[model samples]
Target: VSHEFKTPINAIEGYTMLLQGEELSPDQEEYVEKILFNTQRLSGLVGNILLLSKLENQNIPMKKTEYRLDEQIRQAFLSLETKWTEKEIGFQVELEEVKYTANEGLFMHIWINLLDNAIKFSPSKGTITMFLKQEQDSVKFILEDEGPGIEDDVKSRIFDKFYQVDGSHKAEGNGLGLALVKRIVDSAGGTIKAENREYGGCRFVIELPKQKDEII
Candidate 1:
Protein backbone atom coordinates (compact mmCIF):
# COMPACT_ATOMS: atom_id res chain seq x y z
CA VAL A 1 0.00 0.00 0.00
CA SER A 2 2.81 2.41 0.83
CA HIS A 3 4.50 1.67 -2.50
CA GLU A 4 1.28 2.14 -4.40
CA PHE A 5 0.61 5.53 -2.82
CA LYS A 6 4.16 6.79 -3.12
CA THR A 7 4.14 6.97 -6.90
CA PRO A 8 1.13 9.28 -7.23
CA ILE A 9 2.05 11.29 -4.17
CA ASN A 10 5.49 11.95 -5.52
CA ALA A 11 4.06 12.92 -8.86
CA ILE A 12 1.65 15.37 -7.26
CA GLU A 13 4.39 16.87 -5.10
CA GLY A 14 6.65 17.29 -8.13
CA TYR A 15 3.93 18.97 -10.13
CA THR A 16 3.06 21.22 -7.22
CA MET A 17 6.65 22.37 -6.93
CA LEU A 18 6.77 23.12 -10.64
CA LEU A 19 3.50 25.03 -10.47
CA GLN A 20 4.79 27.07 -7.53
CA GLY A 21 7.70 28.24 -9.69
CA GLU A 22 5.40 29.45 -12.47
CA GLU A 23 4.09 33.06 -12.59
CA LEU A 24 0.49 33.27 -11.45
CA SER A 25 -2.04 35.74 -10.06
CA PRO A 26 -2.25 36.14 -6.31
CA ASP A 27 -5.43 33.99 -6.08
CA GLN A 28 -3.94 31.29 -8.25
CA GLU A 29 -0.76 31.31 -6.21
CA GLU A 30 -2.76 30.92 -3.02
CA TYR A 31 -4.57 27.89 -4.38
CA VAL A 32 -1.33 26.32 -5.49
CA GLU A 33 0.20 26.97 -2.09
CA LYS A 34 -2.72 25.24 -0.41
CA ILE A 35 -2.31 22.29 -2.74
CA LEU A 36 1.37 22.08 -1.93
CA PHE A 37 0.71 22.19 1.78
CA ASN A 38 -1.84 19.40 1.74
CA THR A 39 0.32 17.26 -0.50
CA GLN A 40 3.28 17.69 1.83
CA ARG A 41 1.07 16.84 4.80
CA LEU A 42 -0.13 13.69 3.07
CA SER A 43 3.46 12.73 2.33
CA GLY A 44 4.39 13.17 5.98
CA LEU A 45 1.41 11.07 7.07
CA VAL A 46 2.41 8.29 4.70
CA GLY A 47 5.99 8.38 5.92
CA ASN A 48 4.90 8.16 9.53
CA ILE A 49 2.64 5.23 8.76
CA LEU A 50 5.43 3.36 7.03
CA LEU A 51 7.82 4.09 9.86
CA LEU A 52 5.39 2.92 12.53
CA SER A 53 4.88 -0.28 10.60
CA LYS A 54 8.61 -0.89 10.49
CA LEU A 55 8.90 -0.20 14.20
CA GLU A 56 6.05 -2.58 15.08
CA ASN A 57 7.61 -5.32 12.97
CA GLN A 58 10.99 -4.87 14.65
CA ASN A 59 12.51 -4.09 11.27
CA ILE A 60 14.36 -1.00 12.49
CA PRO A 61 17.52 -1.56 14.51
CA MET A 62 18.84 0.82 17.14
CA LYS A 63 22.16 2.46 16.25
CA LYS A 64 23.40 3.09 19.75
CA THR A 65 26.25 5.55 20.28
CA GLU A 66 27.61 7.70 23.06
CA TYR A 67 26.23 11.23 23.05
CA ARG A 68 25.66 14.08 25.43
CA LEU A 69 21.98 14.09 26.33
CA ASP A 70 21.86 17.80 27.16
CA GLU A 71 23.39 18.75 23.86
CA GLN A 72 20.91 16.60 21.98
CA ILE A 73 18.00 18.30 23.68
CA ARG A 74 19.45 21.74 23.00
CA GLN A 75 19.92 20.93 19.34
CA ALA A 76 16.36 19.67 19.03
CA PHE A 77 15.04 22.87 20.57
CA LEU A 78 17.19 24.96 18.30
CA SER A 79 15.93 23.16 15.24
CA LEU A 80 12.37 24.05 16.19
CA GLU A 81 13.20 27.63 17.01
CA THR A 82 11.16 29.01 14.13
CA LYS A 83 8.04 27.16 15.15
CA TRP A 84 8.05 28.34 18.74
CA THR A 85 9.08 31.83 17.82
CA GLU A 86 6.28 32.16 15.31
CA LYS A 87 3.82 31.17 17.97
CA GLU A 88 5.35 33.65 20.42
CA ILE A 89 5.98 30.89 22.94
CA GLY A 90 8.72 31.12 25.52
CA PHE A 91 10.90 28.34 26.91
CA GLN A 92 12.44 27.55 30.27
CA VAL A 93 15.19 25.02 29.92
CA GLU A 94 17.12 23.51 32.80
CA LEU A 95 19.15 20.71 31.32
CA GLU A 96 21.96 19.07 33.27
CA GLU A 97 24.87 17.53 31.44
CA VAL A 98 24.45 13.79 31.17
CA LYS A 99 26.06 11.20 28.91
CA TYR A 100 23.81 8.63 27.26
CA THR A 101 24.14 5.72 24.89
CA ALA A 102 21.28 5.36 22.45
CA ASN A 103 20.19 5.73 18.87
CA GLU A 104 20.74 9.44 18.36
CA GLY A 105 18.22 9.74 15.56
CA LEU A 106 15.46 7.92 17.38
CA PHE A 107 16.05 9.81 20.59
CA MET A 108 15.88 13.07 18.66
CA HIS A 109 12.41 12.15 17.45
CA ILE A 110 11.28 11.96 21.06
CA TRP A 111 12.37 15.50 21.77
CA ILE A 112 11.00 16.88 18.52
CA ASN A 113 7.57 15.30 18.84
CA LEU A 114 7.18 16.28 22.47
CA LEU A 115 8.30 19.82 21.84
CA ASP A 116 6.12 20.09 18.78
CA ASN A 117 3.11 18.90 20.68
CA ALA A 118 3.75 21.34 23.47
CA ILE A 119 4.03 24.21 21.06
CA LYS A 120 0.96 23.18 19.14
CA PHE A 121 -1.30 22.93 22.17
CA SER A 122 0.06 25.91 23.99
CA PRO A 123 -1.71 29.24 23.75
CA SER A 124 0.09 32.00 21.98
CA LYS A 125 2.70 33.66 24.20
CA GLY A 126 2.53 30.81 26.66
CA THR A 127 5.59 29.20 28.19
CA ILE A 128 6.97 25.69 28.01
CA THR A 129 9.49 24.26 30.40
CA MET A 130 12.00 21.45 29.92
CA PHE A 131 13.89 19.94 32.83
CA LEU A 132 16.54 17.30 32.50
CA LYS A 133 18.57 15.76 35.29
CA GLN A 134 20.59 12.70 36.04
CA GLU A 135 18.99 10.49 38.63
CA GLN A 136 20.74 7.63 40.37
CA ASP A 137 21.07 5.30 37.40
CA SER A 138 18.87 7.01 34.85
CA VAL A 139 18.21 10.33 33.23
CA LYS A 140 15.00 12.16 34.17
CA PHE A 141 13.48 14.29 31.46
CA ILE A 142 10.36 16.36 31.97
CA LEU A 143 8.52 18.61 29.56
CA GLU A 144 5.65 20.77 30.66
CA ASP A 145 3.47 22.96 28.51
CA GLU A 146 1.03 25.74 29.31
CA GLY A 147 -1.98 24.17 27.67
CA PRO A 148 -5.13 22.47 28.70
CA GLY A 149 -4.30 19.45 30.79
CA ILE A 150 -5.25 16.03 29.53
CA GLU A 151 -8.32 14.45 30.98
CA ASP A 152 -8.03 11.34 33.08
CA ASP A 153 -9.60 9.10 30.45
CA VAL A 154 -7.40 10.38 27.63
CA LYS A 155 -4.17 10.10 29.57
CA SER A 156 -4.20 6.31 29.58
CA ARG A 157 -4.49 5.93 25.79
CA ILE A 158 -2.44 8.95 24.66
CA PHE A 159 0.47 6.71 23.68
CA ASP A 160 -1.70 4.30 21.75
CA LYS A 161 -1.31 4.35 17.98
CA PHE A 162 -3.66 6.77 16.18
CA TYR A 163 -5.14 7.90 19.47
CA GLN A 164 -5.69 11.65 19.46
CA VAL A 165 -7.17 13.36 22.44
CA ASP A 166 -10.55 14.97 21.88
CA GLY A 167 -9.38 18.54 21.34
CA SER A 168 -6.29 17.69 19.31
CA HIS A 169 -8.07 16.71 16.10
CA LYS A 170 -7.35 20.09 14.57
CA ALA A 171 -3.62 19.69 15.24
CA GLU A 172 -1.38 18.75 12.32
CA GLY A 173 -0.86 15.16 13.31
CA ASN A 174 -2.36 11.74 12.74
CA GLY A 175 -1.56 10.71 16.33
CA LEU A 176 1.46 8.54 15.49
CA GLY A 177 3.97 10.81 17.20
CA LEU A 178 3.52 9.71 20.79
CA ALA A 179 3.16 6.10 19.77
CA LEU A 180 6.51 6.30 18.02
CA VAL A 181 8.03 8.01 21.03
CA LYS A 182 6.78 5.28 23.35
CA ARG A 183 8.23 2.59 21.11
CA ILE A 184 11.62 4.26 20.93
CA VAL A 185 11.77 4.76 24.68
CA ASP A 186 10.77 1.19 25.28
CA SER A 187 13.49 -0.01 22.95
CA ALA A 188 16.01 1.99 24.94
CA GLY A 189 14.91 0.52 28.28
CA GLY A 190 13.10 3.69 29.31
CA THR A 191 9.73 4.48 30.83
CA ILE A 192 7.49 7.40 29.89
CA LYS A 193 4.23 8.72 31.24
CA ALA A 194 2.04 11.81 31.06
CA GLU A 195 0.04 13.56 33.77
CA ASN A 196 -1.82 16.76 34.40
CA ARG A 197 0.24 19.27 36.32
CA GLU A 198 -1.25 20.84 39.40
CA TYR A 199 -0.49 24.33 38.21
CA GLY A 200 -2.19 23.67 34.87
CA GLY A 201 -1.17 22.12 31.58
CA CYS A 202 0.36 18.66 31.00
CA ARG A 203 3.68 17.12 31.84
CA PHE A 204 5.57 14.28 30.19
CA VAL A 205 8.13 12.45 32.26
CA ILE A 206 10.64 10.08 30.75
CA GLU A 207 13.37 8.18 32.49
CA LEU A 208 16.04 6.58 30.36
CA PRO A 209 18.67 4.36 31.89
CA LYS A 210 22.21 5.69 31.67
CA GLN A 211 25.09 3.65 30.35
CA LYS A 212 27.75 4.82 32.74
CA ASP A 213 30.38 2.45 31.46
CA GLU A 214 30.07 3.53 27.83
CA ILE A 215 32.94 5.77 26.69
CA ILE A 216 32.11 8.58 24.38
Candidate 2:
Protein backbone atom coordinates (compact mmCIF):
# COMPACT_ATOMS: atom_id res chain seq x y z
CA VAL A 1 0.00 0.00 0.00
CA SER A 2 2.79 2.38 0.94
CA HIS A 3 4.69 1.81 -2.28
CA GLU A 4 1.54 1.96 -4.40
CA PHE A 5 0.51 5.27 -2.83
CA LYS A 6 3.92 6.95 -2.62
CA THR A 7 5.19 6.14 -6.09
CA PRO A 8 2.86 8.53 -7.91
CA ILE A 9 3.31 11.35 -5.41
CA ASN A 10 7.10 11.08 -5.70
CA ALA A 11 6.87 11.26 -9.47
CA ILE A 12 4.47 14.20 -9.41
CA GLU A 13 6.57 16.10 -6.90
CA GLY A 14 9.78 15.58 -8.85
CA TYR A 15 8.25 16.69 -12.13
CA THR A 16 6.35 19.58 -10.56
CA MET A 17 9.48 21.03 -8.94
CA LEU A 18 11.40 20.61 -12.18
CA LEU A 19 8.63 22.35 -14.07
CA GLN A 20 8.33 25.15 -11.52
CA GLY A 21 12.03 26.01 -11.89
CA GLU A 22 11.78 26.73 -15.63
CA GLU A 23 11.52 30.41 -16.64
CA LEU A 24 7.80 30.35 -17.31
CA SER A 25 5.15 33.07 -17.35
CA PRO A 26 2.57 33.48 -14.59
CA ASP A 27 -0.08 31.29 -16.24
CA GLN A 28 2.33 28.39 -16.74
CA GLU A 29 3.46 28.66 -13.16
CA GLU A 30 -0.15 28.50 -12.01
CA TYR A 31 -0.66 25.27 -13.94
CA VAL A 32 2.44 23.74 -12.39
CA GLU A 33 1.27 24.76 -8.94
CA LYS A 34 -1.98 22.84 -9.47
CA ILE A 35 0.04 19.76 -10.29
CA LEU A 36 2.12 20.21 -7.14
CA PHE A 37 -1.01 20.70 -5.09
CA ASN A 38 -2.64 17.50 -6.37
CA THR A 39 0.53 15.55 -5.77
CA GLN A 40 0.44 16.70 -2.19
CA ARG A 41 -3.18 15.55 -1.94
CA LEU A 42 -2.20 12.14 -3.25
CA SER A 43 0.58 12.00 -0.66
CA GLY A 44 -1.89 12.54 2.15
CA LEU A 45 -4.21 9.81 0.86
CA VAL A 46 -1.30 7.38 0.76
CA GLY A 47 -0.38 8.35 4.29
CA ASN A 48 -3.89 7.55 5.46
CA ILE A 49 -3.80 4.18 3.71
CA LEU A 50 -0.46 3.36 5.30
CA LEU A 51 -1.75 4.27 8.72
CA LEU A 52 -4.83 2.12 8.17
CA SER A 53 -2.75 -0.84 6.95
CA LYS A 54 -0.53 -0.63 10.01
CA LEU A 55 -3.50 -0.45 12.32
CA GLU A 56 -5.17 -3.43 10.71
CA ASN A 57 -2.07 -5.59 10.38
CA GLN A 58 -0.63 -4.95 13.83
CA ASN A 59 -1.76 -7.24 16.61
CA ILE A 60 -1.77 -4.39 19.08
CA PRO A 61 -5.24 -3.56 20.37
CA MET A 62 -6.96 -0.26 19.71
CA LYS A 63 -8.85 2.02 22.04
CA LYS A 64 -12.51 1.57 21.14
CA THR A 65 -14.88 4.20 22.39
CA GLU A 66 -18.11 6.00 21.62
CA TYR A 67 -16.86 8.95 19.68
CA ARG A 68 -18.85 11.85 18.26
CA LEU A 69 -19.52 11.30 14.57
CA ASP A 70 -19.52 15.01 13.80
CA GLU A 71 -16.01 15.41 15.12
CA GLN A 72 -14.67 12.67 12.89
CA ILE A 73 -16.33 14.27 9.89
CA ARG A 74 -14.78 17.59 10.79
CA GLN A 75 -11.41 15.98 11.37
CA ALA A 76 -11.54 14.40 7.94
CA PHE A 77 -12.24 17.82 6.42
CA LEU A 78 -9.63 19.50 8.57
CA SER A 79 -7.02 17.03 7.42
CA LEU A 80 -7.88 17.73 3.80
CA GLU A 81 -8.32 21.49 4.11
CA THR A 82 -5.38 22.19 1.85
CA LYS A 83 -6.67 19.96 -0.93
CA TRP A 84 -10.13 21.54 -0.86
CA THR A 85 -8.70 25.05 -0.83
CA GLU A 86 -6.52 24.32 -3.80
CA LYS A 87 -9.44 22.92 -5.75
CA GLU A 88 -11.64 25.86 -4.76
CA ILE A 89 -14.29 23.46 -3.42
CA GLY A 90 -16.65 24.19 -0.59
CA PHE A 91 -17.71 21.60 2.00
CA GLN A 92 -21.08 21.77 3.69
CA VAL A 93 -21.79 19.70 6.77
CA GLU A 94 -25.20 18.61 8.05
CA LEU A 95 -24.14 16.46 10.95
CA GLU A 96 -26.33 15.09 13.71
CA GLU A 97 -24.78 14.81 17.13
CA VAL A 98 -24.56 11.05 17.09
CA LYS A 99 -22.05 8.65 18.58
CA TYR A 100 -20.65 5.34 17.43
CA THR A 101 -18.40 2.65 18.92
CA ALA A 102 -15.14 1.76 17.14
CA ASN A 103 -11.41 2.14 17.22
CA GLU A 104 -10.99 5.80 16.43
CA GLY A 105 -7.84 5.11 14.41
CA LEU A 106 -9.49 2.57 12.15
CA PHE A 107 -12.75 4.48 11.94
CA MET A 108 -10.81 7.56 10.95
CA HIS A 109 -9.75 5.82 7.73
CA ILE A 110 -13.38 5.43 6.63
CA TRP A 111 -13.99 9.16 6.70
CA ILE A 112 -10.61 9.89 5.16
CA ASN A 113 -11.29 7.66 2.19
CA LEU A 114 -14.78 9.08 1.71
CA LEU A 115 -13.70 12.70 1.97
CA ASP A 116 -10.67 12.09 -0.23
CA ASN A 117 -12.92 10.74 -2.94
CA ALA A 118 -15.20 13.74 -2.62
CA ILE A 119 -12.36 16.20 -3.04
CA LYS A 120 -11.04 14.32 -6.03
CA PHE A 121 -14.29 14.29 -8.04
CA SER A 122 -15.70 17.62 -6.99
CA PRO A 123 -15.71 20.34 -9.65
CA SER A 124 -13.74 23.51 -9.20
CA LYS A 125 -15.81 25.95 -7.11
CA GLY A 126 -18.32 23.16 -6.47
CA THR A 127 -19.92 22.09 -3.25
CA ILE A 128 -19.47 18.78 -1.43
CA THR A 129 -22.17 18.07 1.08
CA MET A 130 -21.89 15.61 3.97
CA PHE A 131 -24.86 14.23 5.84
CA LEU A 132 -24.59 12.40 9.14
CA LYS A 133 -27.76 11.08 10.66
CA GLN A 134 -28.70 8.66 13.39
CA GLU A 135 -31.13 5.91 12.59
CA GLN A 136 -32.88 3.41 14.83
CA ASP A 137 -30.14 0.82 14.54
CA SER A 138 -27.27 2.62 12.89
CA VAL A 139 -25.69 5.92 12.03
CA LYS A 140 -25.77 7.01 8.41
CA PHE A 141 -22.79 8.71 6.79
CA ILE A 142 -23.33 10.21 3.36
CA LEU A 143 -21.01 12.20 1.11
CA GLU A 144 -22.15 13.89 -2.08
CA ASP A 145 -19.78 15.36 -4.66
CA GLU A 146 -20.60 17.62 -7.61
CA GLY A 147 -18.43 16.08 -10.30
CA PRO A 148 -19.60 13.86 -13.13
CA GLY A 149 -21.58 11.09 -11.47
CA ILE A 150 -20.66 7.46 -11.86
CA GLU A 151 -22.45 5.53 -14.56
CA ASP A 152 -25.20 3.10 -13.64
CA ASP A 153 -23.35 0.20 -15.23
CA VAL A 154 -20.47 0.57 -12.77
CA LYS A 155 -22.42 1.43 -9.67
CA SER A 156 -23.21 -2.13 -8.57
CA ARG A 157 -19.64 -3.35 -8.88
CA ILE A 158 -17.92 -0.27 -7.53
CA PHE A 159 -17.33 -1.69 -4.06
CA ASP A 160 -15.80 -4.84 -5.48
CA LYS A 161 -12.07 -5.31 -4.98
CA PHE A 162 -9.90 -3.95 -7.78
CA TYR A 163 -12.89 -2.26 -9.38
CA GLN A 164 -12.37 1.31 -10.64
CA VAL A 165 -14.42 3.75 -12.61
CA ASP A 166 -12.91 4.09 -16.07
CA GLY A 167 -13.38 7.62 -17.34
CA SER A 168 -11.91 11.07 -17.22
CA HIS A 169 -11.20 12.32 -13.67
CA LYS A 170 -11.15 8.80 -12.30
CA ALA A 171 -8.19 9.28 -9.98
CA GLU A 172 -5.55 6.57 -9.81
CA GLY A 173 -6.80 4.36 -7.02
CA ASN A 174 -5.56 0.82 -6.46
CA GLY A 175 -9.22 -0.12 -5.85
CA LEU A 176 -8.03 -1.18 -2.43
CA GLY A 177 -9.38 1.78 -0.45
CA LEU A 178 -13.05 1.01 -0.93
CA ALA A 179 -12.44 -2.71 -0.53
CA LEU A 180 -10.58 -2.09 2.68
CA VAL A 181 -13.30 0.22 3.83
CA LYS A 182 -15.86 -2.52 3.20
CA ARG A 183 -13.78 -4.99 5.15
CA ILE A 184 -13.42 -2.65 8.11
CA VAL A 185 -17.10 -1.81 8.16
CA ASP A 186 -18.06 -5.46 7.77
CA SER A 187 -15.88 -6.34 10.70
CA ALA A 188 -17.89 -3.89 12.72
CA GLY A 189 -21.15 -5.35 11.38
CA GLY A 190 -21.82 -2.26 9.31
CA THR A 191 -22.95 -1.64 5.73
CA ILE A 192 -21.70 0.68 3.00
CA LYS A 193 -22.54 1.55 -0.57
CA ALA A 194 -21.84 3.86 -3.52
CA GLU A 195 -24.21 5.27 -6.12
CA ASN A 196 -24.81 8.24 -8.38
CA ARG A 197 -27.09 10.78 -6.84
CA GLU A 198 -30.35 11.65 -8.56
CA TYR A 199 -29.45 15.29 -9.02
CA GLY A 200 -25.88 14.52 -10.12
CA GLY A 201 -22.47 13.28 -9.04
CA CYS A 202 -21.50 10.31 -6.85
CA ARG A 203 -22.69 9.61 -3.35
CA PHE A 204 -21.22 7.24 -0.77
CA VAL A 205 -23.49 6.17 2.02
CA ILE A 206 -22.39 4.13 5.04
CA GLU A 207 -24.55 2.73 7.79
CA LEU A 208 -22.68 1.55 10.86
CA PRO A 209 -24.50 -0.09 13.72
CA LYS A 210 -23.97 1.76 16.95
CA GLN A 211 -23.79 -1.40 18.98
CA LYS A 212 -20.81 -3.71 18.83
CA ASP A 213 -21.14 -7.03 17.04
CA GLU A 214 -18.44 -9.63 16.46
CA ILE A 215 -17.11 -9.48 12.95
CA ILE A 216 -18.24 -12.47 10.90
- The most accurate candidate by lDDT is 1
Positional deviation of residue 106's Cα in model 1 after best superposition, in angstroms: 1.3
The 10 consecutive residues of candidate 1 with the worst lDDT sum are: 166-175
Candidate 1 residue runs with Cα over 4 Å from true position: none
Looking at model 2, residue 90 earns an lDDT score of 84
Candidate whose TM-score is highest = 1
Q: Could you give me the TM-score of model 1 versus the true structure?
A: 0.94
State how far residue 69 of model 1 sits from its true place (Å): 2.1
Where model 2 places Cα greater than 4 Å from the true spot, the runs are: 1-62, 167-171, 212-216
lDDT of 1 at 159: 96
